[model samples]
Target: MTSGMAEDHRKPPMRDLLADAAFELFEEKGFEQTTVDDIVARAGVGRRSFFRYFPSKEDVVFPDHERCLDDMVAFLKTAADGTDLVEHACEATLLVARMYAERPERSLMRYRHIRDVPALRDHEHIVIRRYEHALAAFLREGFAFRPDGPLHAEIIAAAASAAHNHAVRTWLRNGATTDAVAAARTALASVRAAWGAPPTPAEPDDYVVVITRSRAPLQDVLHHVEHALARIAPADDAE
Candidate 1:
Protein backbone atom coordinates (compact mmCIF):
# COMPACT_ATOMS: atom_id res chain seq x y z
CA MET A 1 0.00 0.00 0.00
CA THR A 2 2.96 2.35 0.56
CA SER A 3 4.04 1.87 -3.10
CA GLY A 4 7.24 0.25 -1.84
CA MET A 5 8.88 -3.09 -2.79
CA ALA A 6 6.82 -4.91 -0.17
CA GLU A 7 3.63 -4.15 -2.05
CA ASP A 8 3.09 -7.65 -3.45
CA HIS A 9 -0.14 -6.62 -5.07
CA ARG A 10 1.65 -3.89 -6.98
CA LYS A 11 1.00 -5.01 -10.52
CA PRO A 12 3.86 -5.07 -12.93
CA PRO A 13 4.01 -1.57 -14.44
CA MET A 14 1.75 -1.27 -17.45
CA ARG A 15 4.64 -0.21 -19.66
CA ASP A 16 6.59 -3.36 -18.88
CA LEU A 17 3.57 -5.60 -19.12
CA LEU A 18 2.78 -4.17 -22.51
CA ALA A 19 6.36 -4.43 -23.72
CA ASP A 20 6.82 -7.97 -22.46
CA ALA A 21 3.53 -9.06 -23.95
CA ALA A 22 4.24 -7.39 -27.27
CA PHE A 23 7.68 -8.97 -27.63
CA GLU A 24 6.40 -12.39 -26.68
CA LEU A 25 3.62 -12.06 -29.21
CA PHE A 26 6.08 -10.99 -31.86
CA GLU A 27 8.17 -14.06 -31.20
CA GLU A 28 5.23 -16.47 -30.99
CA LYS A 29 2.73 -15.12 -33.53
CA GLY A 30 5.21 -13.07 -35.55
CA PHE A 31 5.42 -9.30 -35.74
CA GLU A 32 3.11 -8.95 -38.74
CA GLN A 33 0.47 -11.16 -37.19
CA THR A 34 0.59 -9.62 -33.70
CA THR A 35 -1.94 -6.81 -33.72
CA VAL A 36 -2.33 -4.11 -31.08
CA ASP A 37 -5.36 -5.93 -29.81
CA ASP A 38 -3.33 -9.06 -29.27
CA ILE A 39 -0.78 -7.17 -27.22
CA VAL A 40 -3.40 -5.38 -25.11
CA ALA A 41 -5.24 -8.62 -24.44
CA ARG A 42 -2.06 -10.27 -23.25
CA ALA A 43 -1.17 -7.33 -21.00
CA GLY A 44 -4.78 -6.92 -19.78
CA VAL A 45 -4.61 -3.26 -20.83
CA GLY A 46 -6.85 -1.32 -23.18
CA ARG A 47 -6.39 0.46 -26.51
CA ARG A 48 -5.88 3.93 -25.02
CA SER A 49 -3.04 2.89 -22.74
CA PHE A 50 -1.27 1.23 -25.66
CA PHE A 51 -1.42 4.42 -27.68
CA ARG A 52 -0.28 6.43 -24.66
CA TYR A 53 2.86 4.33 -24.41
CA PHE A 54 3.75 3.78 -28.10
CA PRO A 55 2.87 5.33 -31.39
CA SER A 56 3.15 2.11 -33.39
CA LYS A 57 3.82 -1.59 -33.09
CA GLU A 58 7.40 -1.27 -34.35
CA ASP A 59 8.11 1.17 -31.54
CA VAL A 60 7.83 -1.67 -29.03
CA VAL A 61 11.01 -3.16 -30.52
CA PHE A 62 13.15 -0.24 -29.44
CA PRO A 63 11.17 1.74 -26.94
CA ASP A 64 14.01 3.63 -25.29
CA HIS A 65 15.49 5.27 -28.41
CA GLU A 66 13.21 8.29 -28.30
CA ARG A 67 14.27 9.08 -24.74
CA CYS A 68 17.88 8.44 -25.69
CA LEU A 69 17.55 10.83 -28.61
CA ASP A 70 16.12 13.50 -26.34
CA ASP A 71 18.94 13.00 -23.86
CA MET A 72 21.51 13.17 -26.69
CA VAL A 73 20.12 16.45 -28.03
CA ALA A 74 20.17 17.84 -24.52
CA PHE A 75 23.81 16.80 -24.19
CA LEU A 76 24.73 18.52 -27.44
CA LYS A 77 22.90 21.70 -26.48
CA THR A 78 24.47 21.84 -23.03
CA ALA A 79 27.94 21.42 -24.54
CA ALA A 80 27.34 23.84 -27.43
CA ASP A 81 28.03 27.03 -25.49
CA GLY A 82 31.78 27.62 -26.04
CA THR A 83 32.53 23.91 -26.06
CA ASP A 84 34.03 21.59 -28.68
CA LEU A 85 31.14 20.94 -31.02
CA VAL A 86 32.75 18.06 -32.92
CA GLU A 87 33.72 16.13 -29.83
CA HIS A 88 30.39 16.73 -28.18
CA ALA A 89 28.47 15.68 -31.25
CA CYS A 90 30.56 12.56 -31.58
CA GLU A 91 30.11 11.75 -27.90
CA ALA A 92 26.39 12.46 -28.01
CA THR A 93 25.70 9.94 -30.75
CA LEU A 94 27.13 7.27 -28.49
CA LEU A 95 23.92 7.40 -26.48
CA VAL A 96 22.33 5.29 -29.22
CA ALA A 97 25.12 2.76 -29.20
CA ARG A 98 25.15 2.75 -25.42
CA MET A 99 21.42 2.22 -25.27
CA TYR A 100 21.78 -0.94 -27.28
CA ALA A 101 24.98 -1.92 -25.50
CA GLU A 102 23.25 -1.74 -22.15
CA ARG A 103 21.03 -4.62 -23.27
CA PRO A 104 22.97 -6.60 -25.83
CA GLU A 105 20.63 -9.59 -25.99
CA ARG A 106 17.54 -7.49 -26.46
CA SER A 107 19.37 -5.29 -28.92
CA LEU A 108 20.37 -8.30 -30.98
CA MET A 109 16.83 -9.60 -30.98
CA ARG A 110 15.51 -6.24 -32.10
CA TYR A 111 18.19 -5.97 -34.75
CA ARG A 112 17.20 -9.35 -36.18
CA HIS A 113 13.54 -8.42 -36.03
CA ILE A 114 14.17 -5.21 -37.88
CA ARG A 115 16.17 -7.03 -40.50
CA ASP A 116 13.27 -9.38 -41.10
CA VAL A 117 10.71 -6.62 -41.34
CA PRO A 118 11.12 -4.09 -44.13
CA ALA A 119 8.84 -1.54 -42.47
CA LEU A 120 10.88 -1.57 -39.29
CA ARG A 121 14.06 -1.22 -41.36
CA ASP A 122 12.67 1.93 -42.96
CA HIS A 123 11.57 3.23 -39.59
CA GLU A 124 15.05 2.61 -38.23
CA HIS A 125 16.53 4.83 -40.92
CA ILE A 126 14.17 7.63 -40.00
CA VAL A 127 15.25 7.33 -36.39
CA ILE A 128 18.92 7.38 -37.35
CA ARG A 129 18.48 10.40 -39.60
CA ARG A 130 16.85 12.31 -36.78
CA TYR A 131 19.97 11.96 -34.66
CA GLU A 132 22.16 13.05 -37.57
CA HIS A 133 19.97 16.09 -38.18
CA ALA A 134 19.99 17.00 -34.52
CA LEU A 135 23.78 16.90 -34.41
CA ALA A 136 24.05 18.95 -37.59
CA ALA A 137 21.61 21.54 -36.33
CA PHE A 138 23.51 21.95 -33.08
CA LEU A 139 26.82 22.30 -34.93
CA ARG A 140 25.29 24.84 -37.30
CA GLU A 141 24.12 26.93 -34.34
CA GLY A 142 27.50 26.73 -32.61
CA PHE A 143 29.45 27.60 -35.76
CA ALA A 144 27.09 30.30 -37.05
CA PHE A 145 29.85 32.88 -37.30
CA ARG A 146 32.19 30.67 -39.30
CA PRO A 147 32.15 31.05 -43.07
CA ASP A 148 31.90 27.30 -43.74
CA GLY A 149 29.98 26.28 -40.67
CA PRO A 150 26.98 24.59 -42.25
CA LEU A 151 28.98 22.30 -44.50
CA HIS A 152 31.41 21.26 -41.80
CA ALA A 153 28.60 20.75 -39.37
CA GLU A 154 26.74 18.39 -41.67
CA ILE A 155 29.88 16.40 -42.44
CA ILE A 156 30.76 15.97 -38.77
CA ALA A 157 27.22 14.97 -37.86
CA ALA A 158 27.11 12.38 -40.63
CA ALA A 159 30.46 11.05 -39.47
CA ALA A 160 29.19 10.66 -35.94
CA SER A 161 26.11 8.80 -37.09
CA ALA A 162 28.21 6.49 -39.20
CA ALA A 163 30.60 5.85 -36.32
CA HIS A 164 27.82 4.81 -33.98
CA ASN A 165 26.15 2.57 -36.55
CA HIS A 166 29.42 0.95 -37.50
CA ALA A 167 30.29 0.25 -33.89
CA VAL A 168 26.92 -1.26 -33.10
CA ARG A 169 26.93 -3.52 -36.14
CA THR A 170 30.44 -4.66 -35.41
CA TRP A 171 29.52 -5.55 -31.88
CA LEU A 172 26.51 -7.53 -32.99
CA ARG A 173 28.25 -9.31 -35.84
CA ASN A 174 31.23 -10.24 -33.73
CA GLY A 175 28.92 -12.35 -31.56
CA ALA A 176 28.88 -9.53 -29.05
CA THR A 177 32.37 -10.60 -28.09
CA THR A 178 33.75 -7.09 -27.47
CA ASP A 179 32.65 -4.70 -24.80
CA ALA A 180 29.91 -2.73 -26.56
CA VAL A 181 30.66 0.59 -24.88
CA ALA A 182 34.36 0.30 -25.60
CA ALA A 183 33.62 -0.70 -29.17
CA ALA A 184 31.42 2.35 -29.53
CA ARG A 185 34.14 4.60 -28.09
CA THR A 186 36.81 3.11 -30.33
CA ALA A 187 34.72 3.68 -33.43
CA LEU A 188 34.20 7.32 -32.47
CA ALA A 189 37.89 7.75 -31.67
CA SER A 190 38.82 6.45 -35.12
CA VAL A 191 36.55 9.01 -36.72
CA ARG A 192 38.01 11.76 -34.55
CA ALA A 193 41.54 10.75 -35.35
CA ALA A 194 40.82 10.64 -39.06
CA TRP A 195 39.66 14.23 -38.80
CA GLY A 196 42.87 15.02 -36.87
CA ALA A 197 41.11 15.19 -33.52
CA PRO A 198 43.30 14.40 -30.55
CA PRO A 199 42.42 10.85 -29.50
CA THR A 200 40.57 11.02 -26.17
CA PRO A 201 42.29 14.23 -25.18
CA ALA A 202 41.96 15.46 -21.62
CA GLU A 203 41.03 18.84 -23.06
CA PRO A 204 39.50 20.04 -26.30
CA ASP A 205 41.86 20.47 -29.23
CA ASP A 206 41.31 22.28 -32.48
CA TYR A 207 41.52 19.95 -35.50
CA VAL A 208 40.15 21.98 -38.40
CA VAL A 209 40.71 25.67 -38.99
CA VAL A 210 38.76 27.71 -41.54
CA ILE A 211 40.59 30.59 -43.13
CA THR A 212 39.62 32.08 -46.48
CA ARG A 213 41.46 34.71 -48.50
CA SER A 214 38.15 35.61 -50.13
CA ARG A 215 34.50 34.50 -50.14
CA ALA A 216 35.51 30.96 -51.08
CA PRO A 217 33.11 28.09 -51.47
CA LEU A 218 32.67 25.72 -48.50
CA GLN A 219 34.03 22.89 -50.65
CA ASP A 220 37.46 24.54 -50.61
CA VAL A 221 37.76 24.17 -46.84
CA LEU A 222 36.49 20.60 -47.04
CA HIS A 223 39.09 19.81 -49.69
CA HIS A 224 41.81 20.99 -47.33
CA VAL A 225 40.62 18.49 -44.73
CA GLU A 226 40.72 15.72 -47.32
CA HIS A 227 44.30 16.48 -48.26
CA ALA A 228 45.41 16.76 -44.65
CA LEU A 229 43.86 13.44 -43.69
CA ALA A 230 45.29 11.76 -46.77
CA ARG A 231 48.74 12.89 -45.68
CA ILE A 232 48.48 10.97 -42.44
CA ALA A 233 48.05 7.18 -42.39
CA PRO A 234 45.00 5.95 -40.50
CA ALA A 235 45.82 3.65 -37.61
CA ASP A 236 42.29 2.42 -36.88
CA ASP A 237 39.49 1.40 -39.18
CA ALA A 238 36.64 2.01 -36.77
CA GLU A 239 37.48 -1.25 -35.01
Candidate 2:
Protein backbone atom coordinates (compact mmCIF):
# COMPACT_ATOMS: atom_id res chain seq x y z
CA MET A 1 0.00 0.00 0.00
CA THR A 2 1.01 3.59 -0.48
CA SER A 3 2.36 5.46 2.55
CA GLY A 4 -0.83 7.53 2.96
CA MET A 5 -3.07 4.47 2.63
CA ALA A 6 -0.98 2.63 5.23
CA GLU A 7 -1.24 5.61 7.58
CA ASP A 8 -5.04 5.73 7.15
CA HIS A 9 -5.31 1.98 7.75
CA ARG A 10 -3.20 1.95 10.89
CA LYS A 11 -4.71 4.86 12.89
CA PRO A 12 -8.02 6.38 13.71
CA PRO A 13 -8.44 10.11 13.11
CA MET A 14 -6.84 12.35 15.71
CA ARG A 15 -10.25 13.83 16.48
CA ASP A 16 -11.63 10.40 17.40
CA LEU A 17 -8.51 9.56 19.38
CA LEU A 18 -8.81 12.75 21.41
CA ALA A 19 -12.54 12.24 22.03
CA ASP A 20 -12.10 8.60 23.13
CA ALA A 21 -9.31 9.61 25.51
CA ALA A 22 -11.35 12.42 26.99
CA PHE A 23 -14.42 10.24 27.49
CA GLU A 24 -12.30 7.59 29.20
CA LEU A 25 -10.79 10.09 31.61
CA PHE A 26 -14.15 11.69 32.26
CA GLU A 27 -15.59 8.30 33.22
CA GLU A 28 -12.79 7.39 35.60
CA LYS A 29 -12.09 10.75 37.18
CA GLY A 30 -15.49 12.37 36.78
CA PHE A 31 -16.10 15.51 34.74
CA GLU A 32 -14.97 17.93 37.44
CA GLN A 33 -11.88 15.94 38.29
CA THR A 34 -10.75 15.21 34.72
CA THR A 35 -8.35 17.78 33.30
CA VAL A 36 -7.32 18.56 29.73
CA ASP A 37 -3.81 17.47 30.63
CA ASP A 38 -5.07 14.06 31.73
CA ILE A 39 -7.04 13.60 28.52
CA VAL A 40 -4.10 14.48 26.25
CA ALA A 41 -1.88 12.18 28.28
CA ARG A 42 -4.29 9.29 27.83
CA ALA A 43 -4.49 9.97 24.10
CA GLY A 44 -0.69 10.01 23.78
CA VAL A 45 -0.94 13.48 22.28
CA GLY A 46 0.14 16.93 23.36
CA ARG A 47 -2.13 19.62 24.83
CA ARG A 48 -1.96 21.32 21.43
CA SER A 49 -3.55 18.28 19.80
CA PHE A 50 -6.45 18.32 22.24
CA PHE A 51 -6.96 22.02 21.70
CA ARG A 52 -6.85 21.45 17.96
CA TYR A 53 -9.94 19.26 18.12
CA PHE A 54 -11.82 20.89 21.03
CA PRO A 55 -11.91 24.41 22.37
CA SER A 56 -12.10 23.17 25.95
CA LYS A 57 -12.80 20.09 28.03
CA GLU A 58 -16.54 20.78 27.87
CA ASP A 59 -16.43 20.79 24.06
CA VAL A 60 -14.91 17.32 24.12
CA VAL A 61 -17.86 16.06 26.18
CA PHE A 62 -20.19 16.93 23.27
CA PRO A 63 -18.12 16.23 20.21
CA ASP A 64 -20.68 15.14 17.63
CA HIS A 65 -23.01 18.15 17.85
CA GLU A 66 -21.31 20.36 15.25
CA ARG A 67 -21.43 17.65 12.63
CA CYS A 68 -24.97 16.75 13.62
CA LEU A 69 -26.06 20.35 13.26
CA ASP A 70 -24.59 20.47 9.77
CA ASP A 71 -26.41 17.28 8.85
CA MET A 72 -29.69 18.77 10.10
CA VAL A 73 -29.25 21.87 7.98
CA ALA A 74 -28.51 19.87 4.87
CA PHE A 75 -31.41 17.53 5.48
CA LEU A 76 -33.83 20.41 5.92
CA LYS A 77 -32.55 22.05 2.77
CA THR A 78 -33.14 18.98 0.59
CA ALA A 79 -35.98 17.22 2.41
CA ALA A 80 -39.21 16.77 0.40
CA ASP A 81 -41.09 19.96 1.26
CA GLY A 82 -44.47 18.47 0.41
CA THR A 83 -45.16 17.97 4.13
CA ASP A 84 -46.47 20.29 6.83
CA LEU A 85 -43.99 22.96 7.89
CA VAL A 86 -44.10 21.78 11.50
CA GLU A 87 -43.62 18.19 10.37
CA HIS A 88 -40.63 19.19 8.28
CA ALA A 89 -39.11 20.91 11.27
CA CYS A 90 -39.69 17.81 13.38
CA GLU A 91 -38.09 15.64 10.73
CA ALA A 92 -34.98 17.83 10.75
CA THR A 93 -34.49 17.30 14.46
CA LEU A 94 -34.26 13.54 13.98
CA LEU A 95 -30.70 13.82 12.74
CA VAL A 96 -29.64 14.53 16.30
CA ALA A 97 -31.70 11.62 17.62
CA ARG A 98 -29.99 9.30 15.18
CA MET A 99 -26.60 10.56 16.34
CA TYR A 100 -27.34 9.69 19.95
CA ALA A 101 -28.91 6.37 18.96
CA GLU A 102 -25.81 5.42 17.01
CA ARG A 103 -23.76 5.33 20.22
CA PRO A 104 -26.04 4.49 23.11
CA GLU A 105 -23.40 3.57 25.66
CA ARG A 106 -21.42 6.71 24.97
CA SER A 107 -24.61 8.75 24.98
CA LEU A 108 -25.57 7.34 28.35
CA MET A 109 -22.19 8.20 29.79
CA ARG A 110 -22.38 11.71 28.36
CA TYR A 111 -25.90 12.11 29.77
CA ARG A 112 -24.65 11.18 33.21
CA HIS A 113 -21.78 13.59 32.95
CA ILE A 114 -24.07 16.42 31.86
CA ARG A 115 -26.52 15.75 34.66
CA ASP A 116 -23.75 15.91 37.21
CA VAL A 117 -21.96 18.97 35.87
CA PRO A 118 -23.65 22.36 35.84
CA ALA A 119 -21.18 23.82 33.38
CA LEU A 120 -21.57 20.93 30.98
CA ARG A 121 -25.34 21.16 31.21
CA ASP A 122 -25.24 24.87 30.41
CA HIS A 123 -22.94 24.22 27.49
CA GLU A 124 -25.32 21.59 26.23
CA HIS A 125 -28.17 24.13 26.11
CA ILE A 126 -26.06 26.33 23.91
CA VAL A 127 -25.33 23.42 21.60
CA ILE A 128 -29.03 22.57 21.40
CA ARG A 129 -29.91 26.13 20.46
CA ARG A 130 -27.77 25.83 17.36
CA TYR A 131 -29.87 22.92 16.20
CA GLU A 132 -33.06 24.82 16.94
CA HIS A 133 -31.86 27.78 14.93
CA ALA A 134 -31.12 25.61 11.92
CA LEU A 135 -34.60 24.13 12.02
CA ALA A 136 -36.21 27.55 12.40
CA ALA A 137 -34.26 28.98 9.49
CA PHE A 138 -35.38 26.19 7.22
CA LEU A 139 -38.99 26.55 8.30
CA ARG A 140 -38.84 30.30 7.87
CA GLU A 141 -38.07 29.89 4.18
CA GLY A 142 -40.90 27.40 3.75
CA PHE A 143 -43.36 29.75 5.45
CA ALA A 144 -42.11 32.90 3.73
CA PHE A 145 -45.34 33.49 1.82
CA ARG A 146 -47.28 34.00 5.05
CA PRO A 147 -47.15 37.31 6.96
CA ASP A 148 -46.69 35.32 10.19
CA GLY A 149 -43.96 33.27 8.60
CA PRO A 150 -41.21 34.11 11.05
CA LEU A 151 -43.42 33.52 14.06
CA HIS A 152 -44.64 30.25 12.65
CA ALA A 153 -41.09 29.14 11.96
CA GLU A 154 -39.83 29.92 15.45
CA ILE A 155 -42.70 28.19 17.25
CA ILE A 156 -42.44 25.00 15.22
CA ALA A 157 -38.67 24.98 15.57
CA ALA A 158 -38.94 25.15 19.34
CA ALA A 159 -41.60 22.45 19.34
CA ALA A 160 -39.50 20.16 17.20
CA SER A 161 -36.41 20.64 19.37
CA ALA A 162 -38.41 20.06 22.54
CA ALA A 163 -39.99 16.87 21.18
CA HIS A 164 -36.67 15.46 20.03
CA ASN A 165 -35.02 16.25 23.37
CA HIS A 166 -37.86 14.72 25.34
CA ALA A 167 -37.62 11.42 23.48
CA VAL A 168 -33.82 11.15 23.58
CA ARG A 169 -33.58 12.08 27.25
CA THR A 170 -36.29 9.64 28.21
CA TRP A 171 -34.49 6.91 26.33
CA LEU A 172 -31.19 7.79 27.97
CA ARG A 173 -32.76 7.71 31.42
CA ASN A 174 -34.22 4.28 30.62
CA GLY A 175 -30.74 2.95 29.75
CA ALA A 176 -31.24 3.49 26.01
CA THR A 177 -32.43 -0.06 25.26
CA THR A 178 -35.44 1.18 23.31
CA ASP A 179 -35.28 2.62 19.81
CA ALA A 180 -34.37 6.31 20.19
CA VAL A 181 -35.08 7.18 16.57
CA ALA A 182 -38.55 5.64 16.68
CA ALA A 183 -39.32 7.45 19.93
CA ALA A 184 -38.24 10.75 18.37
CA ARG A 185 -40.46 10.11 15.34
CA THR A 186 -43.44 9.48 17.62
CA ALA A 187 -42.80 12.60 19.67
CA LEU A 188 -42.39 14.75 16.55
CA ALA A 189 -45.63 13.43 15.14
CA SER A 190 -47.36 15.09 18.05
CA VAL A 191 -45.85 18.42 16.99
CA ARG A 192 -47.19 17.87 13.50
CA ALA A 193 -50.66 17.20 14.86
CA ALA A 194 -50.62 20.33 17.01
CA TRP A 195 -49.22 22.91 14.59
CA GLY A 196 -49.51 21.34 11.17
CA ALA A 197 -51.75 23.36 8.88
CA PRO A 198 -55.04 21.69 8.04
CA PRO A 199 -55.77 20.57 4.50
CA THR A 200 -57.09 23.36 2.32
CA PRO A 201 -60.86 23.19 2.07
CA ALA A 202 -61.49 22.17 -1.49
CA GLU A 203 -63.18 24.96 -3.48
CA PRO A 204 -64.96 24.44 -6.79
CA ASP A 205 -62.89 27.17 -8.51
CA ASP A 206 -59.65 26.86 -6.50
CA TYR A 207 -57.22 23.99 -6.81
CA VAL A 208 -53.71 24.00 -5.36
CA VAL A 209 -51.02 22.01 -7.05
CA VAL A 210 -47.68 21.07 -5.44
CA ILE A 211 -44.77 19.30 -7.07
CA THR A 212 -42.87 16.77 -4.99
CA ARG A 213 -40.92 13.57 -5.30
CA SER A 214 -42.94 10.39 -5.96
CA ARG A 215 -41.43 8.79 -2.88
CA ALA A 216 -42.09 11.74 -0.57
CA PRO A 217 -43.91 11.07 2.69
CA LEU A 218 -47.71 11.50 2.72
CA GLN A 219 -47.55 14.26 5.32
CA ASP A 220 -45.42 16.36 2.99
CA VAL A 221 -48.05 16.31 0.32
CA LEU A 222 -50.75 17.50 2.73
CA HIS A 223 -48.55 20.28 4.08
CA HIS A 224 -47.37 21.65 0.76
CA VAL A 225 -50.83 21.67 -0.77
CA GLU A 226 -52.35 23.35 2.27
CA HIS A 227 -49.71 26.07 2.31
CA ALA A 228 -50.08 26.58 -1.42
CA LEU A 229 -53.81 27.13 -1.06
CA ALA A 230 -53.32 29.41 1.96
CA ARG A 231 -51.16 31.77 -0.14
CA ILE A 232 -53.97 32.21 -2.64
CA ALA A 233 -56.03 34.22 -0.16
CA PRO A 234 -56.74 37.93 -0.83
CA ALA A 235 -54.09 40.41 0.35
CA ASP A 236 -56.22 41.66 3.24
CA ASP A 237 -57.16 38.12 4.21
CA ALA A 238 -53.48 37.14 4.42
CA GLU A 239 -52.97 39.87 7.01
Best by lDDT: 2
Residue 22, candidate 2: Cα error in Å is 0.8
Tens-digit lDDT string for candidate 1 (1-239): 12234424567666667888888888888789999999999988788888877899988877787888899888887873546677788888878877887777777777778879999999889888999999999989877898998998888888878888988888887767578777878888866776534455453342435466566777886887776655453433343
Clashing pairs in 1: none
Model 2 residue runs over 4 Å out of place are: 1-10, 80-83, 199-239
**Pairs with backbone N, CA or C atoms under 3 Å apart (clashes), candidate 2:** 82-220, 83-220
lDDT of each: 0.79, 0.86
- TM-score (C-alpha) between model 1 and the true structure: 0.75
lDDT of 1 at 9: 55
